[model samples]
Target chain A: MGGSTDSGSQNRLGRRLLTERVSGYWLQGAGYFAIVLFALIVLALLYQSLPLLSEYSLVQMLTSSNWDPAQNQFGFLPAIVGTVYVTALTMIMGTPIAILAAIYIAEYAEGRTKTLVSSFIDVLAAIPSVIFGLVALIVVVPFVGDYLAPAVGSSATGLGIFTVSLVMAIVVTPFMISLSVESLEALPDELRESSLGVGATKWETIRIVLLRAAGPGIFSAVLLGFGRVFGATIVPAMLIGGQTHLPSSPFATGQTLPTLIVNDFGELMSLPLTQSALIFVGLMLIVVVWLFNFSAMILRQRLQQRWQF
Target chain B: MDRYTEQRLFGLLARGAAALVVAVMVLVISVTIYRGGRVFLMDPTIVITPPGSRYMLEGDGGFLHAVLGSIFIVGPATIISAVLAVSTAIYLQSDYSSERFSDTVNMFLNVLWGTPPIVYGVFVLTVIIAIGARTSMFFGIVAIAIFQYPIMTRYTDEALRSAPDSVKEATYGLGATRFETALMTARAALPGVIAGIVMGFARGIGDAATVLFTAGRSTNMPAGPFDGATTLPVLIFDQAMSFNAEVRSHAYAASFILIIAVLGLILVSKLLAGRYARYAPGGRHS
Candidate 1:
């Protein structure tokens, strides 16, 4: 092999390699910023929450319903249970409608209808959560207090777990539908055509082929929607009546984690343990959200391996 | 029932479900427009005029302060977030990081994106307290920037990933540096990048949770980035909770404007993405 000892070419090659290495390192550094921010946030929440933990056992925080901060009671049991109830109810109410609507959009609806429905979903998703709370306060609260609650063999003041879940269902429906539609649309057309060619009807093709293919994506969509409802602040804060008790029923008023922090935030920041309690609430949200995300990731991976669709 | 009829029934049910969702959206939007529209028609001045003394008590003046505050805090936050998000997205490519590393980074991003905005509020509030600083537009911007970063990055990353790989290859084949190659590929994904920025801006301006404790509501006009200022969402939140008829009406009015702005931005993002798609390779769309 003939080697060219040209100094200029060698210098240029060296410079190019140097540029490559430097830029790669710089880009990786930028990419790591997300991790850095995540660590800082978790650390900050944990560190600030230490004071409250020092005062009360973790079990007491999770089990007791006594939340009178005036008496130094800071039980988080109600908030945890309320969040679970609201989120579960919201998913139960919203998911079926969203998934079916998404199926219509991705499989049945065509041309103008598809575009219009998608645009509606996007706009709905983009609406501020505060407005959702505002509208619910004005409209649904009165209706529930006057009619819906009385008809259900229960008396109510309208703001309760039920109302919060209903409004939150509406708030999260569009988001879930948007994601579900995206997943369904991502399936290869061949999956549909092959099923159809094999004597499968349109619905049959979608049920067997497209749905199976897009299962993990749709699952994650629901998971993400769950996260949205779990962390929702304004709707529950305004409509859940802020009773701060363990929810007696769907018609009974109570506070979730986010609403607890929001309702308690204004004047309570002055008290040190109270401040830690609130920050601890924030920490709980972060921890739970992380759990959801990690579980979603792992489950998606496992589903992908199993489905092989 | 036979399979054909059963399929037909299922199709009808799905269509009904779709109709229900559509009906819900329409009901919400129309309700908003009806309630908030009347306020605007009665007094367009409310959106334009600044708050006077006893704005919440008397409902005598407009919410110009919130309008300006939203602009001041979110505008700069969007710009900063766009740069960081795009860079982070570009760096997630094979040129900069391995697949495993990028995947880990993405998990972090997803968690951040999923974290409640209130947590960001709490974290930033803790910072403000630790630093002995008042709730101000400065911290508001910082909180919003942090909140928007992951959202924008995720969108930008998806856009870049979906770009035609041929464009990337040709750039590298032309002896371009990785940075230059990234710039070329980024331009190829320009429509999506711009859409991401617009979405982040919309989210930043529309969110109350991130700025609720950090921005601190005020009737006074914005003094500076360091001063406490209120945004439209925050104003609506306070107004709705004030339990006064007049204040509630203002909340409806303020929200009407906010909804219009957000919806308009969503439309603009769609139009811009569509328009710009035609200029990029393999990105053309109707």
Candidate 2:
């Protein structure tokens, strides 16, 4: 009887252990569910967008500049060009200033000053994109309309690609500063000391040795900033003035892919083909932004590996 | 060139660039304050009244409904996201997962994080339509939650991974189940988890793109998750785009309030992270 009772208790314990292991498996499965959801989102977008291929040839849809939804002719060239132009302009305007600020914070500023500057960048990062749009609408637009546009021999409505790009530059500067600061800070102090010991000036050391070592990280930061600028909808949508045609100048109004979706999505739903075309825009955004993000991640991973070795 | 000249020139350029950034930030804040401050100077009633109130030519309207709507949408969404994110973090950091799997998960999360919020809005809009549901706070909450999920999960995973392995081993040696071990690990990483949740909440509240199409705009305060609601960001967007000068000024006022709330949240998260740093093993070196 004693042996039988002992065996019964052992069986119960075994069942309990088995139940516990099963619960653990369930938990891990739940974790993987996020990945499943992401894949589903991608698939849904692709499925919705595939119909556009039948309506318009891929080359015609992508290359043609005319986009008249009322006439059933849909083209994405204008928005595509606007997106590329605005993102490029933002990088050109923002990157150098951000790098300089980051260098000052990472290499030059001491205790209190460093903390203050870093906090400023953090605060900038935390500000809402809508707020940036609103402020730009009030301040930057009027300035461009009144002063800069006229100076450049363009009519000054102040709602144009250039105005949008300027706001975008400001919006993305904080991200660049923070990322570049991390890359700069991650460099070894030994390198700086050796450079100085070898009779190199501080500026020369930073320009040559420190920057070269941190190049991959800094490049990744710029790529991340590009991704951010590309994905941004609210700021550009609010400021870009919703023009569908190709811009004649930086001072001319334009639309980006995200802005196109945001501005016309409500009306586009009534037209099935136009809705599908909008889905294609969303798909394009996903593709471009994902590439930038993936490349940045890879570069950062490689940098980490280098440091580990 | 002489070393002194080169150093001086570089220093000058750096300072000038840094100052420019500072100037830009200052300019933005000052412009908003100057313009938004007008609402207070003219009629404080406009700033205090609930949405759907009568609009006078002199800017007599309030955004209380938008403020409340934002809270209603973000509060439950943040809670839902936090629960999912913490669960995912706990499971992924457990011994059942492999390094390769973790890396893959991280890569997926990075991609998700980089996705435009507008795309999320579009995706949710399609889902809502297919299900025959109207645009409402429920849809908005779901959309924002989706956007916050990867962010919260990534941060929480970092925190959980920082938990010392010895503590985990001790729990396992005591005959604790994997679930119990995860619970213990979560307790140790509570501060970081809280910080992550707060960060996600801030991002969700500040975001306009994700909710733009999912949540139909309503003038009245949100009745429930099913009711159409308008948020502060959406309100700002609508008002800023209006042709009327008074409405534009009102948008600036709304922007100021939103800015204050978001900045406060960021500050709190920073303080919380700092407070919990000592408990994290990685915190010691940093």
Model 1 stretches astray by more than 4 angstroms = A1-26
Residues A212-264 of candidate 2: C-alpha lDDT, one tens digit per residue: 78877788778878888998999999898898999989988999999999888
Q: Please give the lDDT score at residue B122 for candidate 2.
A: 84
TM-score of chain B of each: 0.96, 0.87
By summed lDDT, the worst window of 10 consecutive residues in model 1 chain B runs over: B277-286
lDDT of 2 at B57: 32
Give the runs in model 2 whose Cα sits over 4 Å from its true position.
Answer: A1-26, A296-309, B40-48, B53-61, B173-175, B274-286
TM-score of 1: 0.95
- TM-score of each candidate structure, all chains considered together: 0.95, 0.91
Candidate 2 lDDT over residue span B141-214, tens digit each: 99999999988998899878877887698889998877777887876786778778887888899899989888
TM-score of the A chain in candidate 1: the value is 0.91
